[model samples]
Target: MDRKGILAARVSVFIVSICFIAMGIMRNEHFVVFKKAVKICLECIGLG
Candidate 1:
């Protein structure tokens, strides 16, 4: 990948990780919306 592509990929992964972490916290706080979002993130990350 080119430098720009690598940077974009890194940014994407970082954003995804942040989303997952936020969802996890929301889940712990009893937010149903976050639970679904977390599931989607897991699938996207190939962990679901």
Candidate 2:
């Protein structure tokens, strides 16, 4: 590929990697909040 095409490809890959990493971090946070929320909801429903 030409230089510009190669550069664009590299940039796209970098962006994708960064997005994946960010989502992974957010996923962890989401699970933590999700677990707590589920517990609270269950208690409110008198199942816990």
Candidate 3:
């Protein structure tokens, strides 16, 4: 795509990311998901 199209795509992605983060924070899902992710990582590394 052209410069304007690329800029628009990046802006939309940033906006969506921010909105998702805000919703996760408001609902406390971020921390819960983080905890689960860490657990999964540890298990994958054979340290769980």
Task: Return the top candidate by lDDT.
Answer: 3
Model 1: CA > 4 A from native: 29-48
Each candidate structure's TM-score, on Cα atoms with residue i matched to residue i, is 0.55, 0.56, 0.69
Error of 2 at 12 (Å): 0.4
Task: Extract clashing residue pairs from model 2.
Answer: none
Error in Å for residue 16 of model 2: 0.8
lDDT of the candidates, in the order given: 0.81, 0.85, 0.91
- For 1-48, candidate 2 gives per-residue lDDT tens digits of 999999999999999999987897777976776778876576678886
List residue ranges in candidate 2 displaced over 4 A. 29-48
TM for candidate 1 is 0.55
Candidate 2, residue 23: Cα displacement in angstroms equals: 0.3
Q: Would you give me the overall lDDT of model 2? A: 0.85
Better of 1 and 3 by lDDT: 3
lDDT of 2 at 10: 99
On TM-score, the leading prediction is 3
Model 3 RMSD vs true structure: 2.8
Per-residue alpha-carbon lDDT of model 3 for 2-23, expressed as tens digits?
A: 9999999999999999999999
